[model samples]
Target: MKQEYEALFTPWKIGNLEIKNRIVLAPMGGTCIFGWMEPGGSHFDKEAARLLLKIAKHDCGLIIPGIAPVKDMLGGKWLYQNKRKFAELAEFMDELHATGAKMFVQMTAGFGRSFALTAPLAMLAKNKALNTLAKPYIDAEYLTAAPSVLPNRWADDVTTRAITEKEIKDIIYAFGETARLCKEAGVDGVEVHAVHEGYLLDQFTLKYTNKRTDDYGGSFENRYRFAAEIVKEIKDKCGDDFPVSLRYSVRSMTKAFQYGAMPGEDFEEIGRDMEESERAAKFLQDAGYDMLNCDNGTYDAWYWAHPPQYMPQNCNLEDVEHIKKFVDIPVVCAGKMEPDVGAKAVKEGGIDAMAVGRQFLADPKWVSKIKKGREEEIRPCICCHSACFNLTKHNGTANDQDLTESAGMCKCAVNPRSMQSKKYRVKPTDKPKRVAIIGGGVGGMEAARILALRGHEAEIYEKTSELGGVFIAAAAPEFKEKDKQLIAWQKHQLKKLGVKIHYNYEVKPDSLPSADEYIIATGAEANRIPIPGAADYAMDATDYLLGRKQVGKDVVIIGGGLTGCEIALDLFRKGKNPQIVEMKDDLIAVKNMCLANTSYLRDCFKTNKVPVYLNAGVAEITDKSVKVNLKDGRTVELPADDVIMSVGYHPIPLLQAAKNVHLLGDCKKVGNIRSAIWGAWDIAMKI
Candidate 1:
């Protein structure tokens, strides 16, 4: 074996089991799941198995699946019922084992407070009428306790009912049963999904959400009982030698602390703070857990856990460092640990192992790339949270949205090979062809790279002196450095594939060059907003942002989409309080930014005293000032040194008369980073 690859290939032992490598595939779900007792009844879905198998083939040391319900049919749950199908699952597991990786099924309980009913469940215990109204929305057996008693935050009217002693016993039994099933299914190990703001276990574990008066609640000892009991059950049932890991969040920055919504005041729940994480971790280790999977945040107080693009990458590293003090067992750190950071974490003793969730989704070959000393080739996750958290709000189910739309499977911003693994693998053809891609942005770069990799002669023509197109301007805003990672990764891939690049060159329909095929990836430009005196005082957001033009002091930014909000923040950073006026009901309307990151940005605005006027439209612009119309039919005049317009962007003019030309990127439609990249991927695959 090559010396550079030795680090990843070395084996590491956990308890009695030895894993082939140091790489661990962080857990994630790509399809809807339920308990065995739900409406559809839990059955093995072959699609999920296939996806897992694909991940397994990547040859990571450990692979952890997302939450597998232990309570069977606990209402509206997507249960795992096909115990007999273990043989099929085992085939994938065996394949991974063959590759020197160990597969683990993650068992979870306590999803009662997931939906809106969690609020009502709490309200029901306080008042009966609210329970009756919430009953319609409640799903499954809430096990022994009601959703309200579950530790989480929701609208003021919602609350959870307390759990009885018998219910606690039932919860313990569920873990044991779930563990036994995994042991029989031939998994190398089992992981307890006691993290996040999920079902029963966490409901009782988190202090703010757990309000029990019994031995299971109130004090730290009482709270530790829930997770401890489950861990004991798994060890007892799975046998002492079985490798069992416990995943838990050390920090609970719930919404109550960040931005109290509905009926509560915004305040962090100090009860479940870092100190609590340390205590829980030690308790779990003592209870016979072979390892600790360190995770953070919850759905109720979503941001504290998920964070967002604005939050620094590796936000949870500090928490991991804190947990390491109390536990002697291996601590696996998760939450946006990229390749370099993860590799550094290993060297710095931040944790025993690094868990990658969104990073792997952006590129399944990440670990492989890092091991091969190809660090720059690793695709970076932008942490946009569009496909992960934001989409779930609209579809009601995370899996339904991810597999169908949100970059299916993996989440590379500029690569479409995510969930479409089996459907779209790289293949070679007998005959190669010549291809021309016009544009140097994400989409055009992706197309050109893919075409060249497939043994085709690919040439790229970018109209500007640079290649990134609007992305160069997009990265100009505050905290959008990760977006640059996407551009950098794409540019690297394009260069490695030997794709020819021609900058500052535009293509005309009338004057064209003959090739096997032409892909029009001409990106979009800032929309011309019509308002009097706009030209004199206003500057396009892209121009001012990309450094193509400069803005004077005390600026007014028009159009409150993602670009505008980001620009406003950047301006704020520069000591300028840019007022943003939007015609829409909300700011940053189009993008699915993470709630936690967005909350932090909102806090920044408040901190900096920057004004964001939603539902306010620009009426006209004067050289000295601008007039605006509020949604309430009120008009106001505001003085401004300059105006930055981010109303919208239109496709670059790709001579429509061009024949045998396929259009992609901003020119095809004004879409997101994923759309542009996937457009290129799809077009190149066909060519």
Candidate 2:
């Protein structure tokens, strides 16, 4: 093990509890020991327990699973009512304790206005009578109720009503009961699901959300009264010796409703500032909290809490370190935290521990691998959030996520086996066959790797010299270092698996390789606009991203999708002026992409003053300008030194129908990495 990382391996104390190491598995949305968002009473989720137990065995010091609501979402039963689940957890904890790791059940009060409203739920909330009818099963009104009346985060039309004092008291009582139950279940401690992320409890704490004139609003103490009461209740019920951790956000980092402040941007905070956070930290500690599991951001500024690749490494360290001074209790920082940096902070008394969330979903053995000085073998999390916790929302949309993803939240995009152990696990096949994978992109490589793991002869044919196909171009941005790391990791895996690769060998349909089965992962070609002068003036998005072409001082990007928006941001960062023209109503207006990732790009564009023309289409391209037609039937010519086309892609498969031939990735359908890898897995498993 590296000497610099020794501090991370050292024991740490949170109240009377002593953790074996400084690595804390921060809670995610779906990996709760208790089921989340299901239409039934709370029960022990074996799948979630299996994943957590694996992490515990991997040398994680403290394990915190996803938020287990104090009240069940569907049945509206208090969590303490489900004593059988706690009994099951008690048995599970014996196995977990054998691994020398402590566990914490993070109990959430509720989402309130931050509840990610789906289209069907939004409909229920809009009609009072329908909501009343649905209250017995799935109460949309109660679920969306906030500290005060506020607009729902995902749905624009739905307004959350202010929660009553009676409901607040009920929830506080529930927290105490739940914490007591967790302690009885052999759980080491409990972390409050937060006075962070602008959830119900956070809504009560923030002045922007809590407008009540009564005991729970206005003044700082009043605003935080609900949170203070929760810890006090838990301490009173479970005894003061039982540690209680608070999920604390050092600053809100929000500017307005549905708007977030970008990193390094100068803006007036509309949510919690440092001054109040300093005072609140001390107050909450004094109130009975044992530790602070800290980060920054609300649901509005979600990128700060659930950071994408665009966010810097150790994004929340400085703020978390500063907050540590205000409270004597241990502080743990999350949000894109790097291990070495976290280790240094732990050694310097900057922070007590480092909390990591999504990376565990990407690679459960990362800690063990790091401890063995095999960091390169660890799979990297690209922070795409495509498969995991991608509750997407855009203009004129609700949550907009697929129902399956909404229910199963913590599945990793890169590593399929994170939450899904049974379905995606590698098993040796008795009947081995030679598999030829066409194209050396992510999908092809993944297919080859899986086949080789299944005791089959697997080989990849690449047209280009490199393995990463369009993803190489996609990951070329400076901010996409993790993506680059992923590519390296994949290459290393392929080499280690002994998968054969033929570079600069493009396979035509007529000139196919001699294999029992053929997997086509030829990828996609960029769609070019048919406008006049486009061929001469406009370059493909890949051209710019791959550094094959350069853009001048002023640039116009056609298509306001994720690729186009990211390019615009990249150009803006390079001190080049970039404008966007889109036919859609909003940028990245697609389902299954995380708001945390998209919102950062959207907010960055808005903050940097990058011109974005929505509901607009390109009419023609010129050498120095591009003519665009607006939604109002008006044509305008914008000055442009260069034109970049990022409209979309179309699959160009080698063969559509052939015996023993299967198509995956962009060759089958033009989609993101999630589709490509999962598609590869589906086909590879069958073969």
- Candidate 2, residue 600: the lDDT equals 95
For candidate 1, write residues 51-96 as lDDT tens digits.
Answer: 5556667767788866566644334332334465555566656665
- On the 0 to 100 scale, the lDDT of residue 214 in model 2 is 97
User: Which residue pairs come into collision in candidate 2?
Assistant: none
lDDT of 2 at 543: 93
What TM-score does each of the candidates earn? 0.84, 0.99
Estimate, for each residue in 1-687, the C-alpha lDDT of model 2 and write its tens digit.
999999999998999899999999999999989996676867899999999999999999999999999999878888898889989999999999999999999999999899999999999999999998988888899999999999999999999999999999999999999999889889999999899989889999998898999999999999999999999999989999999999989999999999999888789998999998999999999999999999999999999999998999999999999999988999999999999999999999999999999999999989999999999999999989998889999999999998888888899888888788989978889999998999999989999989999999999999988999999999998999999999999999999999999999978878989999999898889997788989999999999998999889999999999999889988988999999999999999999889999999999888878999999988889998999999999999999999999999999999894779998998888999898888888888888
* Model 1 poorest ten-residue lDDT run: 394-403
What's the count of clashing pairs in each model shown? 41, 0
- In Å, residue 489's CA in model 1 sits off its true spot by 3.0
